[model samples]
Target: MSSFHIYGHRGSSGTHPENTLLSFQAAHKAGAQGIELDVQLTKDLVPVVIHDERLERTTNGIGFVKDFLYEDLVRLDAGHSFSSRFQGNSIPSLKSVLEWITSNSLMLNIELKNGRFPYDHLETKVLELLTHYHLYDRTIISSFNHYSIQRLTQNGCKVETAILLMEKLVEPWDYLQQVGANSIHIECGAIDEYFITNTHKRGIPVRAFTVNDPYQIAALKKAGCSAIFTDFPLVAMQSI
Candidate 1:
Protein backbone atom coordinates (compact mmCIF):
# COMPACT_ATOMS: atom_id res chain seq x y z
CA MET A 1 0.00 0.00 0.00
CA SER A 2 1.18 3.52 -0.73
CA SER A 3 1.49 5.71 2.36
CA PHE A 4 1.22 9.46 2.54
CA HIS A 5 4.53 11.31 2.84
CA ILE A 6 5.17 12.67 6.34
CA TYR A 7 6.73 16.13 6.51
CA GLY A 8 7.75 17.75 9.76
CA HIS A 9 6.06 21.09 10.21
CA ARG A 10 8.52 23.76 11.28
CA GLY A 11 10.86 20.93 12.10
CA SER A 12 9.00 18.96 14.78
CA SER A 13 7.86 22.21 16.34
CA GLY A 14 5.64 20.44 18.88
CA THR A 15 8.75 19.23 20.69
CA HIS A 16 11.47 21.73 19.82
CA PRO A 17 11.42 25.41 18.93
CA GLU A 18 10.14 26.09 15.44
CA ASN A 19 12.63 26.78 12.62
CA THR A 20 15.69 26.21 14.69
CA LEU A 21 18.48 23.80 13.82
CA LEU A 22 17.69 21.72 16.89
CA SER A 23 14.08 21.36 15.83
CA PHE A 24 15.16 20.30 12.34
CA GLN A 25 17.62 17.81 13.74
CA ALA A 26 14.93 16.39 16.00
CA ALA A 27 12.55 16.03 13.08
CA HIS A 28 15.14 14.19 11.00
CA LYS A 29 15.90 11.89 13.94
CA ALA A 30 12.19 11.29 14.38
CA GLY A 31 12.12 9.71 10.88
CA ALA A 32 10.35 12.45 8.97
CA GLN A 33 10.87 11.88 5.26
CA GLY A 34 10.83 15.58 4.61
CA ILE A 35 10.76 18.88 6.53
CA GLU A 36 8.91 22.14 5.99
CA LEU A 37 10.26 25.47 7.21
CA ASP A 38 9.73 29.19 6.69
CA VAL A 39 12.38 31.64 5.51
CA GLN A 40 12.69 35.42 5.84
CA LEU A 41 15.40 37.85 4.84
CA THR A 42 17.29 40.01 7.30
CA LYS A 43 18.21 43.63 6.69
CA ASP A 44 21.40 42.34 5.12
CA LEU A 45 19.30 40.30 2.69
CA VAL A 46 20.60 37.11 4.21
CA PRO A 47 18.05 34.31 4.20
CA VAL A 48 17.24 33.03 7.66
CA VAL A 49 14.93 30.31 8.93
CA ILE A 50 12.04 31.89 10.86
CA HIS A 51 8.24 31.88 10.76
CA ASP A 52 7.07 35.31 11.90
CA GLU A 53 7.96 38.75 10.63
CA ARG A 54 8.50 39.81 14.22
CA LEU A 55 11.09 38.30 16.51
CA GLU A 56 9.37 38.64 19.90
CA ARG A 57 7.18 35.61 19.40
CA THR A 58 9.88 33.01 18.82
CA THR A 59 13.15 34.56 19.86
CA ASN A 60 14.58 36.60 22.71
CA GLY A 61 14.63 39.78 20.69
CA ILE A 62 12.63 42.86 19.88
CA GLY A 63 11.39 44.44 16.65
CA PHE A 64 11.01 42.98 13.17
CA VAL A 65 13.45 40.35 11.99
CA LYS A 66 14.17 42.39 8.88
CA ASP A 67 15.28 45.28 11.07
CA PHE A 68 18.38 43.42 12.26
CA LEU A 69 21.56 42.54 10.48
CA TYR A 70 22.64 38.95 10.10
CA GLU A 71 25.37 39.42 12.71
CA ASP A 72 22.97 40.87 15.27
CA LEU A 73 20.15 38.41 14.64
CA VAL A 74 22.33 35.37 15.23
CA ARG A 75 23.04 36.55 18.79
CA LEU A 76 19.42 36.17 19.86
CA ASP A 77 18.39 32.86 21.40
CA ALA A 78 15.78 31.33 19.17
CA GLY A 79 14.99 28.36 21.39
CA HIS A 80 14.82 29.60 24.99
CA SER A 81 11.26 30.89 24.81
CA PHE A 82 10.16 27.39 23.97
CA SER A 83 12.20 25.71 26.70
CA SER A 84 15.26 26.21 28.89
CA ARG A 85 16.92 23.16 27.42
CA PHE A 86 17.38 25.02 24.14
CA GLN A 87 18.29 28.35 25.72
CA GLY A 88 21.36 28.95 23.59
CA ASN A 89 19.93 27.97 20.24
CA SER A 90 20.25 30.68 17.63
CA ILE A 91 18.39 31.34 14.43
CA PRO A 92 19.90 29.33 11.58
CA SER A 93 20.65 30.57 8.10
CA LEU A 94 19.09 29.06 4.99
CA LYS A 95 22.57 27.75 4.21
CA SER A 96 22.51 25.87 7.50
CA VAL A 97 19.23 24.16 6.73
CA LEU A 98 20.26 23.48 3.15
CA GLU A 99 23.37 21.75 4.41
CA TRP A 100 21.29 19.54 6.69
CA ILE A 101 18.87 18.72 3.91
CA THR A 102 21.66 17.83 1.52
CA SER A 103 23.53 15.77 4.07
CA ASN A 104 20.48 13.80 5.11
CA SER A 105 18.99 13.42 1.63
CA LEU A 106 15.71 14.85 2.96
CA MET A 107 13.01 16.56 0.97
CA LEU A 108 12.55 20.25 1.78
CA ASN A 109 9.62 22.59 1.53
CA ILE A 110 11.01 26.14 1.73
CA GLU A 111 8.09 28.48 2.39
CA LEU A 112 8.97 32.03 1.41
CA LYS A 113 7.50 34.30 4.11
CA ASN A 114 7.22 37.32 1.82
CA GLY A 115 3.50 38.04 1.98
CA ARG A 116 3.77 40.90 4.47
CA PHE A 117 7.40 41.86 3.89
CA PRO A 118 8.31 41.48 0.30
CA TYR A 119 12.05 41.36 0.57
CA ASP A 120 13.71 42.60 -2.58
CA HIS A 121 15.21 39.85 -4.77
CA LEU A 122 14.13 37.18 -2.27
CA GLU A 123 13.30 34.79 -5.06
CA THR A 124 16.67 35.13 -6.75
CA LYS A 125 18.55 35.04 -3.48
CA VAL A 126 16.78 31.86 -2.35
CA LEU A 127 17.33 30.26 -5.72
CA GLU A 128 21.01 31.17 -5.66
CA LEU A 129 21.44 29.36 -2.35
CA LEU A 130 19.55 26.31 -3.54
CA THR A 131 21.68 26.19 -6.64
CA HIS A 132 24.85 26.66 -4.63
CA TYR A 133 24.05 23.49 -2.70
CA HIS A 134 22.67 21.73 -5.81
CA LEU A 135 19.39 21.03 -4.00
CA TYR A 136 16.84 22.50 -6.37
CA ASP A 137 15.63 19.12 -7.60
CA ARG A 138 14.93 17.90 -4.08
CA THR A 139 13.23 21.10 -2.95
CA ILE A 140 9.71 22.49 -3.23
CA ILE A 141 9.33 26.25 -2.99
CA SER A 142 5.97 27.40 -1.62
CA SER A 143 4.52 30.76 -0.73
CA PHE A 144 1.24 32.31 0.40
CA ASN A 145 1.94 35.11 -2.07
CA HIS A 146 1.03 33.95 -5.53
CA TYR A 147 3.15 36.73 -6.96
CA SER A 148 6.20 35.21 -5.38
CA ILE A 149 5.33 31.87 -6.89
CA GLN A 150 4.86 33.53 -10.26
CA ARG A 151 8.14 35.38 -9.82
CA LEU A 152 9.98 32.15 -9.05
CA THR A 153 8.82 30.58 -12.27
CA GLN A 154 9.59 33.76 -14.11
CA ASN A 155 13.13 33.68 -12.80
CA GLY A 156 13.60 30.14 -14.20
CA CYS A 157 13.33 28.33 -10.92
CA LYS A 158 13.22 24.64 -11.83
CA VAL A 159 12.39 23.59 -8.29
CA GLU A 160 8.85 22.38 -7.83
CA THR A 161 6.40 25.10 -6.78
CA ALA A 162 3.35 24.92 -4.55
CA ILE A 163 0.94 27.69 -3.65
CA LEU A 164 -0.23 27.83 -0.05
CA LEU A 165 -3.93 28.57 0.33
CA MET A 166 -6.24 28.98 3.29
CA GLU A 167 -9.50 29.88 1.55
CA LYS A 168 -11.68 28.17 -1.02
CA LEU A 169 -11.08 28.85 -4.66
CA VAL A 170 -13.69 28.60 -7.39
CA GLU A 171 -11.20 27.07 -9.81
CA PRO A 172 -8.14 25.88 -7.93
CA TRP A 173 -6.70 23.88 -10.81
CA ASP A 174 -6.86 26.89 -13.13
CA TYR A 175 -5.12 29.01 -10.53
CA LEU A 176 -2.52 26.32 -9.97
CA GLN A 177 -1.60 26.25 -13.66
CA GLN A 178 -1.64 30.05 -13.83
CA VAL A 179 0.99 30.19 -11.12
CA GLY A 180 2.94 27.22 -12.56
CA ALA A 181 2.47 25.22 -9.41
CA ASN A 182 2.79 21.46 -9.47
CA SER A 183 1.06 21.00 -6.12
CA ILE A 184 -1.32 22.66 -3.69
CA HIS A 185 -0.35 23.26 -0.09
CA ILE A 186 -3.62 23.79 1.70
CA GLU A 187 -5.37 23.72 5.05
CA CYS A 188 -6.20 20.14 6.03
CA GLY A 189 -9.89 20.88 6.66
CA ALA A 190 -10.32 22.15 3.11
CA ILE A 191 -9.40 18.74 1.68
CA ASP A 192 -12.04 16.12 0.87
CA GLU A 193 -12.78 13.48 -1.73
CA TYR A 194 -13.94 15.98 -4.33
CA PHE A 195 -10.97 18.32 -3.90
CA ILE A 196 -8.47 15.45 -3.99
CA THR A 197 -10.06 13.76 -6.98
CA ASN A 198 -10.19 16.95 -9.03
CA THR A 199 -6.56 17.93 -8.44
CA HIS A 200 -5.27 14.39 -8.86
CA LYS A 201 -6.85 14.20 -12.26
CA ARG A 202 -4.71 17.15 -13.29
CA GLY A 203 -1.50 15.49 -12.07
CA ILE A 204 -1.21 17.84 -9.11
CA PRO A 205 -0.61 16.64 -5.58
CA VAL A 206 -2.23 18.07 -2.45
CA ARG A 207 -0.24 18.54 0.72
CA ALA A 208 -2.13 19.29 3.94
CA PHE A 209 -0.64 21.52 6.59
CA THR A 210 -0.16 21.35 10.35
CA VAL A 211 -2.13 18.16 10.78
CA ASN A 212 -1.52 16.44 14.16
CA ASP A 213 -4.37 14.06 14.82
CA PRO A 214 -3.95 10.36 14.05
CA TYR A 215 -7.50 10.01 12.72
CA GLN A 216 -7.03 13.04 10.48
CA ILE A 217 -3.77 11.63 9.16
CA ALA A 218 -5.44 8.33 8.39
CA ALA A 219 -8.36 10.06 6.71
CA LEU A 220 -6.06 12.22 4.61
CA LYS A 221 -4.15 9.16 3.49
CA LYS A 222 -7.41 7.38 2.69
CA ALA A 223 -8.41 10.44 0.66
CA GLY A 224 -5.17 10.07 -1.37
CA CYS A 225 -3.30 13.08 -0.05
CA SER A 226 0.24 13.22 -1.39
CA ALA A 227 1.67 14.27 1.97
CA ILE A 228 0.89 15.84 5.32
CA PHE A 229 2.71 18.52 7.32
CA THR A 230 2.62 17.75 11.03
CA ASP A 231 4.25 19.10 14.15
CA PHE A 232 4.59 15.60 15.54
CA PRO A 233 6.29 13.72 12.72
CA LEU A 234 7.13 10.69 14.85
CA VAL A 235 3.49 10.32 15.84
CA ALA A 236 2.32 10.81 12.27
CA MET A 237 4.84 8.31 10.96
CA GLN A 238 3.72 5.79 13.59
CA SER A 239 0.00 6.40 13.14
CA ILE A 240 0.07 6.06 9.38
Candidate 2:
Protein backbone atom coordinates (compact mmCIF):
# COMPACT_ATOMS: atom_id res chain seq x y z
CA MET A 1 0.00 0.00 0.00
CA SER A 2 1.06 3.54 -0.64
CA SER A 3 1.27 6.29 1.99
CA PHE A 4 -2.23 7.07 3.25
CA HIS A 5 -3.41 10.64 2.72
CA ILE A 6 -4.69 12.83 5.58
CA TYR A 7 -7.56 15.21 4.90
CA GLY A 8 -8.81 17.74 7.42
CA HIS A 9 -12.46 17.24 8.19
CA ARG A 10 -14.09 20.61 7.61
CA GLY A 11 -10.56 21.98 7.53
CA SER A 12 -9.06 21.29 10.96
CA SER A 13 -12.43 21.68 12.62
CA GLY A 14 -11.11 20.48 15.97
CA THR A 15 -9.28 23.78 16.46
CA HIS A 16 -10.91 26.17 14.00
CA PRO A 17 -14.43 26.96 12.89
CA GLU A 18 -15.81 24.31 10.59
CA ASN A 19 -15.91 25.09 6.85
CA THR A 20 -14.62 28.66 7.17
CA LEU A 21 -11.55 29.73 5.21
CA LEU A 22 -9.58 30.14 8.44
CA SER A 23 -10.04 26.46 9.23
CA PHE A 24 -9.00 25.51 5.71
CA GLN A 25 -5.82 27.55 5.92
CA ALA A 26 -5.02 26.05 9.31
CA ALA A 27 -5.43 22.57 7.88
CA HIS A 28 -2.90 23.28 5.12
CA LYS A 29 -0.47 24.76 7.60
CA ALA A 30 -0.87 21.70 9.78
CA GLY A 31 0.56 19.50 7.00
CA ALA A 32 -2.67 18.00 5.80
CA GLN A 33 -2.39 16.81 2.21
CA GLY A 34 -6.10 17.39 1.51
CA ILE A 35 -9.24 19.07 2.86
CA GLU A 36 -12.78 17.73 2.96
CA LEU A 37 -15.71 20.15 2.97
CA ASP A 38 -19.44 20.20 2.47
CA VAL A 39 -21.38 22.07 -0.23
CA GLN A 40 -24.95 23.36 -0.04
CA LEU A 41 -26.78 25.50 -2.56
CA THR A 42 -28.12 28.82 -1.36
CA LYS A 43 -31.56 30.20 -2.21
CA ASP A 44 -30.23 31.83 -5.38
CA LEU A 45 -28.38 28.66 -6.44
CA VAL A 46 -24.89 29.72 -5.42
CA PRO A 47 -22.76 26.96 -3.91
CA VAL A 48 -21.48 27.66 -0.38
CA VAL A 49 -19.14 25.70 1.89
CA ILE A 50 -21.03 24.56 5.00
CA HIS A 51 -21.97 21.26 6.64
CA ASP A 52 -25.45 21.88 7.95
CA GLU A 53 -28.80 22.44 6.29
CA ARG A 54 -29.66 24.73 9.18
CA LEU A 55 -27.53 27.80 9.95
CA GLU A 56 -27.85 28.00 13.74
CA ARG A 57 -25.21 25.37 14.47
CA THR A 58 -22.32 26.99 12.61
CA THR A 59 -23.36 30.60 12.26
CA ASN A 60 -25.01 33.42 14.18
CA GLY A 61 -27.97 33.19 11.85
CA ILE A 62 -31.07 31.05 12.27
CA GLY A 63 -33.22 28.93 9.90
CA PHE A 64 -32.43 26.80 6.90
CA VAL A 65 -29.51 27.64 4.64
CA LYS A 66 -31.57 27.00 1.51
CA ASP A 67 -33.91 29.77 2.60
CA PHE A 68 -31.20 32.44 2.42
CA LEU A 69 -29.58 34.10 -0.57
CA TYR A 70 -25.82 34.08 -1.01
CA GLU A 71 -25.63 37.78 -0.37
CA ASP A 72 -27.35 37.34 2.98
CA LEU A 73 -25.53 34.16 3.86
CA VAL A 74 -22.12 35.71 3.31
CA ARG A 75 -22.77 38.34 5.94
CA LEU A 76 -23.29 35.90 8.82
CA ASP A 77 -20.50 35.46 11.38
CA ALA A 78 -19.48 31.94 10.46
CA GLY A 79 -16.46 31.85 12.74
CA HIS A 80 -17.70 33.42 15.95
CA SER A 81 -19.45 30.31 17.13
CA PHE A 82 -16.17 28.45 17.37
CA SER A 83 -14.21 31.21 19.12
CA SER A 84 -14.18 34.92 19.75
CA ARG A 85 -10.86 35.14 17.95
CA PHE A 86 -12.62 34.26 14.70
CA GLN A 87 -15.20 36.98 15.10
CA GLY A 88 -16.33 38.80 11.93
CA ASN A 89 -15.28 35.94 9.68
CA SER A 90 -18.00 35.46 7.08
CA ILE A 91 -19.21 32.34 5.40
CA PRO A 92 -17.23 31.33 2.33
CA SER A 93 -18.60 30.50 -1.05
CA LEU A 94 -17.43 27.47 -2.96
CA LYS A 95 -15.93 29.84 -5.54
CA SER A 96 -13.87 31.56 -2.84
CA VAL A 97 -12.63 28.20 -1.54
CA LEU A 98 -11.75 27.14 -5.06
CA GLU A 99 -9.84 30.38 -5.58
CA TRP A 100 -7.88 29.77 -2.37
CA ILE A 101 -7.23 26.15 -3.38
CA THR A 102 -5.67 27.25 -6.67
CA SER A 103 -2.59 28.49 -4.80
CA ASN A 104 -2.11 25.18 -2.93
CA SER A 105 -1.73 21.49 -3.85
CA LEU A 106 -4.44 20.17 -1.50
CA MET A 107 -6.79 17.50 -2.80
CA LEU A 108 -10.47 18.43 -2.31
CA ASN A 109 -13.30 16.16 -1.27
CA ILE A 110 -16.64 17.95 -1.79
CA GLU A 111 -19.53 16.24 -0.07
CA LEU A 112 -22.90 17.42 -1.34
CA LYS A 113 -25.48 17.97 1.44
CA ASN A 114 -28.66 17.52 -0.58
CA GLY A 115 -30.09 14.42 0.96
CA ARG A 116 -32.80 16.25 2.88
CA PHE A 117 -34.06 18.93 0.50
CA PRO A 118 -32.76 17.59 -2.81
CA TYR A 119 -31.57 20.96 -4.14
CA ASP A 120 -32.23 21.22 -7.85
CA HIS A 121 -29.29 21.26 -10.28
CA LEU A 122 -26.84 20.93 -7.37
CA GLU A 123 -24.74 18.33 -9.14
CA THR A 124 -24.60 20.46 -12.28
CA LYS A 125 -23.72 23.65 -10.38
CA VAL A 126 -20.91 21.99 -8.41
CA LEU A 127 -19.52 20.43 -11.60
CA GLU A 128 -19.55 23.83 -13.27
CA LEU A 129 -17.52 25.38 -10.46
CA LEU A 130 -15.01 22.53 -10.47
CA THR A 131 -14.64 22.97 -14.23
CA HIS A 132 -14.28 26.73 -13.92
CA TYR A 133 -11.39 26.19 -11.51
CA HIS A 134 -9.95 23.35 -13.63
CA LEU A 135 -9.83 21.17 -10.51
CA TYR A 136 -11.49 18.02 -11.78
CA ASP A 137 -8.19 16.16 -11.77
CA ARG A 138 -7.72 16.71 -8.02
CA THR A 139 -11.32 16.80 -6.84
CA ILE A 140 -13.50 13.98 -5.59
CA ILE A 141 -17.28 14.51 -5.51
CA SER A 142 -19.13 12.34 -2.98
CA SER A 143 -22.65 12.38 -1.57
CA PHE A 144 -24.83 10.26 0.68
CA ASN A 145 -27.53 10.74 -1.92
CA HIS A 146 -26.75 7.88 -4.26
CA TYR A 147 -29.16 9.33 -6.83
CA SER A 148 -26.96 12.40 -7.17
CA ILE A 149 -23.92 10.19 -7.70
CA GLN A 150 -25.79 8.25 -10.35
CA ARG A 151 -26.85 11.46 -12.02
CA LEU A 152 -23.30 12.73 -12.22
CA THR A 153 -22.04 9.52 -13.73
CA GLN A 154 -24.97 9.30 -16.16
CA ASN A 155 -24.24 12.84 -17.28
CA GLY A 156 -20.64 11.75 -17.93
CA CYS A 157 -18.89 13.58 -15.11
CA LYS A 158 -15.16 13.47 -15.81
CA VAL A 159 -13.89 13.69 -12.26
CA GLU A 160 -13.76 10.89 -9.75
CA THR A 161 -16.91 10.27 -7.71
CA ALA A 162 -17.25 8.35 -4.47
CA ILE A 163 -20.38 7.05 -2.82
CA LEU A 164 -20.70 8.05 0.84
CA LEU A 165 -21.81 5.15 3.01
CA MET A 166 -22.88 5.24 6.65
CA GLU A 167 -23.40 1.51 7.14
CA LYS A 168 -21.77 -1.66 5.93
CA LEU A 169 -23.03 -2.98 2.65
CA VAL A 170 -22.80 -6.48 1.25
CA GLU A 171 -20.32 -6.57 -1.66
CA PRO A 172 -20.00 -2.79 -1.90
CA TRP A 173 -17.80 -3.14 -4.99
CA ASP A 174 -20.79 -4.30 -6.96
CA TYR A 175 -22.71 -1.28 -5.75
CA LEU A 176 -19.85 0.93 -6.82
CA GLN A 177 -20.04 -0.50 -10.31
CA GLN A 178 -23.78 0.07 -10.36
CA VAL A 179 -23.41 3.71 -9.29
CA GLY A 180 -20.39 4.36 -11.52
CA ALA A 181 -18.37 5.61 -8.57
CA ASN A 182 -14.59 5.22 -8.47
CA SER A 183 -14.26 4.71 -4.70
CA ILE A 184 -15.96 4.58 -1.32
CA HIS A 185 -16.06 7.08 1.59
CA ILE A 186 -17.50 5.19 4.52
CA GLU A 187 -17.94 5.75 8.23
CA CYS A 188 -14.76 4.66 10.05
CA GLY A 189 -16.35 2.20 12.45
CA ALA A 190 -17.99 0.32 9.59
CA ILE A 191 -14.74 -0.46 7.81
CA ASP A 192 -12.08 -3.07 8.71
CA GLU A 193 -8.97 -4.66 7.21
CA TYR A 194 -10.90 -7.38 5.42
CA PHE A 195 -13.25 -4.89 3.84
CA ILE A 196 -10.40 -2.66 2.75
CA THR A 197 -8.39 -5.54 1.27
CA ASN A 198 -11.41 -6.96 -0.51
CA THR A 199 -12.37 -3.59 -1.92
CA HIS A 200 -8.78 -3.02 -3.02
CA LYS A 201 -8.78 -6.28 -4.87
CA ARG A 202 -11.73 -4.99 -6.88
CA GLY A 203 -9.80 -1.83 -7.73
CA ILE A 204 -11.90 0.32 -5.41
CA PRO A 205 -10.21 2.51 -2.84
CA VAL A 206 -11.66 3.02 0.64
CA ARG A 207 -11.43 6.34 2.44
CA ALA A 208 -12.70 6.53 6.03
CA PHE A 209 -14.40 9.57 7.54
CA THR A 210 -14.15 11.59 10.79
CA VAL A 211 -11.36 9.41 12.23
CA ASN A 212 -9.66 11.13 15.23
CA ASP A 213 -8.02 8.53 17.48
CA PRO A 214 -4.30 8.08 16.79
CA TYR A 215 -4.52 4.30 17.08
CA GLN A 216 -7.43 4.13 14.61
CA ILE A 217 -5.59 6.40 12.20
CA ALA A 218 -2.48 4.24 12.35
CA ALA A 219 -4.53 1.07 12.05
CA LEU A 220 -6.37 2.33 9.00
CA LYS A 221 -3.12 3.38 7.39
CA LYS A 222 -1.71 -0.11 7.98
CA ALA A 223 -4.92 -1.59 6.57
CA GLY A 224 -4.23 0.12 3.23
CA CYS A 225 -6.83 2.87 3.42
CA SER A 226 -6.39 5.37 0.62
CA ALA A 227 -7.11 8.31 2.93
CA ILE A 228 -8.71 9.45 6.19
CA PHE A 229 -10.80 12.48 7.10
CA THR A 230 -10.03 13.90 10.54
CA ASP A 231 -10.81 16.99 12.58
CA PHE A 232 -7.18 17.13 13.81
CA PRO A 233 -4.97 16.96 10.76
CA LEU A 234 -1.77 17.65 12.69
CA VAL A 235 -2.42 14.86 15.16
CA ALA A 236 -3.40 12.46 12.40
CA MET A 237 -0.26 13.28 10.44
CA GLN A 238 1.84 12.59 13.51
CA SER A 239 0.11 9.26 14.18
CA ILE A 240 1.47 7.62 11.05
For each candidate, the alpha-carbon lDDT, in order, equals 0.91, 0.94
Q: lDDT tens string, model 2, 57-96?
A: 8999999999999999999999888999999988899999
The total number of steric clashes, by the backbone 3 Å criterion, in model 1 comes to 0
> What TM-score, computed on C-alpha atoms, does each candidate reach?
0.98, 0.98
Top-lDDT candidate index: 2
State which candidate has the highest TM-score. 2
Worst ten in a row by lDDT for model 2: 192-201
